[model samples]
Target: MLFDGDNDQKNKFIDHSMWNRLINDAKTPLTKGVHQFQVDLEEFLNIEKPNSKRGDLKPINVIKKHVSGEIAMDKLEELKAIVHGITSV
Candidate 1:
């Protein structure tokens, strides 16, 4: 399983802060900005999936991995594009 330890290391990544704001911001309904949804999304990243590399498809983990330089440039670009699309809306 992909590991995100309990040290709050995500603070070291710029994208993590961006996502934290997006998820927690009172204006966005992306995940309703609610406590339960926040918890669920975090837990959801830990669930195993078939036919895919670990943490490859999870957006939450993607941000973490991308910011940590664990993922590819193309993947990062893809994520940026997606973010651009969302923020542009």
Candidate 2:
């Protein structure tokens, strides 16, 4: 099964028992804080509910639409800062 397949179709790619253990670990307090940063970042970028069918509407595409235009200068700087902050962490 391919990675793009539905969950059931991709089950063959994983060790279910080990996957279950990882899922359980994800619910623990230590892992909870780690995942929260991802949620916050997605919300900050307005891509928290990304739709595969509308890739062009995402931030990267939006930024690309006006990268060379004056209107995008401030936004581009803001985006650069956010990206750098994430990478630095």
Candidate 3:
């Protein structure tokens, strides 16, 4: 019943596609350097629990385990490459 409304599925699909595009496109330096996994993890956590503090126990633990230590630029480039590979495939 979550997608009970008319066009809900379509809307969700579009929303996901837009999110993918935003995460994958590397035109902006800020966007290019962030890891997609990080972005996805954030999204997952946000949906699983809304309005939770970033440093809250659950979210903090999740981020601590998955967040990278690499420099931002390096992480961005890696994400760009991953997106490129996915698009090419």
Candidate 4:
């Protein structure tokens, strides 16, 4: 027997696998904390969620209220460490 599939099938498979891996790996607090920080960063950048058209800048503006220069630098370092750890996996 022979089988055939389209690009969409392959893309979906890859996406599903990648998402599963990410979810499984996020069980650790270090990974979960970094992932949450990334989500917050996206919100602070006024990024619209998938399929959303509106961009709200209020969250971006509020960044300064919660983050200072020194704290920002420290967070940057933490982000880098998290990224490096993920990539090495």
Candidate 5:
């Protein structure tokens, strides 16, 4: 079925199964640290809970914060690594 059709219609193109594994494991933080990071990162960026805007500016904001020294470079690198790991799944 189309993903996020009930909330973020723009993301209706995504298949539900493609995201099911992540959502299913989200609450089990012991093995879902990446999911937890995603949740917290979205919260920190004032992002909405929908993936409709696939290219949201929140990540860019995080980068901007890093460049402006609001967030440390090491932490930014950690975020990047985590993001890469998650998306590569």
Candidate 6:
């Protein structure tokens, strides 16, 4: 099954697509001033801090959260939460 697939090139596109949507959404605001998005982003990164600390995972480990399936639901939610970190929401 494709689910079992592990093509690095294909996975890079998937990761970019996912993160770009979020990064674009959480990138800027209508007003020119400090924003909560930064703080929320920090919190979001902290969620994955454990995996980061290990230094064993790939640089694009967020993509793995997808391969992990629903087992990584909370991580997805954290991603959503981070995307909403922008004032646009």
Instruction: Give me the candidate number with maximum TM-score.
Output: 5
Whole-model lDDT values for every prediction: 0.44, 0.42, 0.41, 0.42, 0.49, 0.41
Candidate 5, run of 10 with poorest lDDT = 1-10
State the weakest 10-residue window (summed lDDT) of model 2: 1-10
TM-score order of candidates, top first: 5, 2, 6, 1, 4, 3
lDDT of 6 at 10: 31
Model 2 ranges with Cα > 4 A deviation:
1-64, 67-71
**TM-scores, one per candidate:** 0.29, 0.30, 0.26, 0.28, 0.34, 0.29
Q: Which residue pairs in model 3 clash with each other?
A: 33-76
Clash count, predicted structure 2: 0
lDDT of 2 at 58: 55
Superior by lDDT: candidate 4 or candidate 6? 4
Kindly give the number of clashing pairs for every candidate: 0, 0, 1, 0, 0, 0
Predict model 1's lDDT versus the native.
0.44
Tens digit per residue, CA lDDT, model 4, 1-89: 00111111236326544554455565655542333332345443343343234436534544553464423556567656766666553
Per-residue accuracy of model 3 over 1-89 as CA lDDT, tens digit each? 01111222236336654555544564454332333443344343333332455435644554454465322555456545666664542
- The numbered model that scores best in lDDT is 5
Off by over 4 Å in 4: 1-39, 42-71
Cα deviation of 26 in candidate 1 (Å)? 14
Global Cα lDDT for candidate 5: 0.49
- Once model 1 is optimally superposed onto the true structure by TM-score, how far is the C-alpha of residue 22 displaced, in angstroms? 19
Candidates 3 and 4 compared by TM-score, better number: 4
Error of 2 at 19 (Å): 20
lDDT per residue, candidate 6, 1-89, as tens digits?
A: 00111212236336644444444456344533222333233244443523545744533464554555523467568656544663335
Clashing pairs in 1: none
RMSD of 1: 12.5
* Model 5, runs deviating above 4 Å: 1-22, 25-34, 42-64
